[model samples]
Target: MPAQPIHTNRLILIPFTLKITKTLMAGDIGILQKLGLQLTPYWPDQEAIDTFPKIIHNLEKVTEPTGFESYMVVHRNSMSVIGDAGFKGLPNDDGEVDIGYAIITQAQKNGYGLEVAKGLASWAFKQPSVKAITARCLLDNKPSARVLEKLGMQQVSTDVELIRWKMMNPAHEQDTIDC
Candidate 1:
């Protein structure tokens, strides 16, 4: 089955398909209309545009999205894609997956970042293969650090340039219970 859209209180995370990523990379706004989505003036910003090729390459590896790739972050109220967020890919050998999110400048500070991160983590934990989710932010990016902290992730380590964080799935513990 195709991955279903993940709905949070204020946003809908639609998994990016090959077609959507290609169209967006081609600089076509028609894809927005076709998907019944609106675009914020700040969306498709340079970072998002640059990520399309990677998203496309990942999408090509699977016949359908497994909800482990990029998703369009749409505001529930405006139906406008404010940004993008999702897992970098499937879980690693250790059953850990890395996540990342970006909300357009105009949509920042509305708690959307936390909402989307929580939603993604929640969805990921439901997958039997996912035991933990990880993320990273620059040492100077306090806002991003705050979002990760809000999602219950702990700062596992840090390099000169980046802070790495991780959150283990609570359900994984329950599954290992000896009762």
Candidate 2:
């Protein structure tokens, strides 16, 4: 059942749907354009992340990478694509990968981010080849750090704008215990 797909109570982590391309890009210059507009008013606004073209471009990059996989975080009840989350850098000799996620502005504050994060990490651990998952957040982004902590990542370092965290696969419990 590995790679069967992961789900949280409020969201579903599944393969990106082609239909999302239109739904996300409609009514604006592009999807990132719409997302940027939608997120512009929030505190510490991530207008940079909302660039529709970049988001779409990154989504395609994730899909085409032979070493990793990505999923669109769909809100099941609303039947809407609220964000993206995925593991990157897989298949590298390093046995490590970076996990990333960005939930739409309106979706913040609720527990969905933490829930989906944990779900995705758990799913990643289930993969036989995955040894560890990592994530980093801007030092000021307490919310993102909180989600990483909820998923059992230990803070490994901090530098200027970034805080790095790592979660080792459960199979590697002995190493963690020994440390």
Candidate 3:
């Protein structure tokens, strides 16, 4: 099936295409115009760029016919790419998958991350065989943790540098999330 772009009230989440990924690598971010996104100069941050190869590889290696892949978060009204999000890969045998997302520092705290997570997580839960979604954030990233909390995710674990959160599919788990 063709990639079915996920949509929200103000954002569109679509997978990162190879062509655009190449453009991003070349630092010609203007190419996002193809997606109607006018991203801020702060985009293509070092971390996102550094991880592009692995993300591209994950996109190429998806086992399911239809499931999650990293997505560029495009703001509908401003037509700017605000961030990247979506599941990290296919669901495991136990029906769990990890999620990764980020918004520009300039756009942080404006709720784009929450909206993207809400849309992507709901979409993932609706897909075949998905039972839960997990996320991790640096200990200092309170805003990111709040996005998870608002998404009905509960703190499941923590380590020296990061905290882990997870939300089981309400259809399958007895526990409820506040979202």
Best by TM-score: 1
Among the numbered candidates, top lDDT falls to: 1
Better of 2 and 3 by TM-score: 3
Q: Which stretches of candidate 3 lie over 4 Å from their true place?
A: 63-67, 174-179
Candidate 1 global CA lDDT score: 0.92
Per-residue lDDT for 1-179 in model 2, tens only? 12334788888875433344435455322443333222223312244235434445544655443324556566777655577677654545656778888787887798888988888777777767777888999999999999899889999999999999988888876766898
lDDT of 1 by residue, 94-160 (tens): 8999999999898899999999999999999999899889999999999999999989999999999
TM-score of each: 0.95, 0.71, 0.88
TM-score: which is higher, 1 or 2?
A: 1
lDDT of each: 0.92, 0.66, 0.80
Candidate 3 residue-wise lDDT, 147-177, digit = tens? 9999999999999999999889877674334
Number of colliding residue pairs in each model: 0, 4, 1
Sorting all predicted structures by lDDT, with the top scorer first, yields 1, 3, 2
| Sort by TM-score, top down from the best | 1, 3, 2
**Cα miss at 81, model 1 (Å)?**
0.5
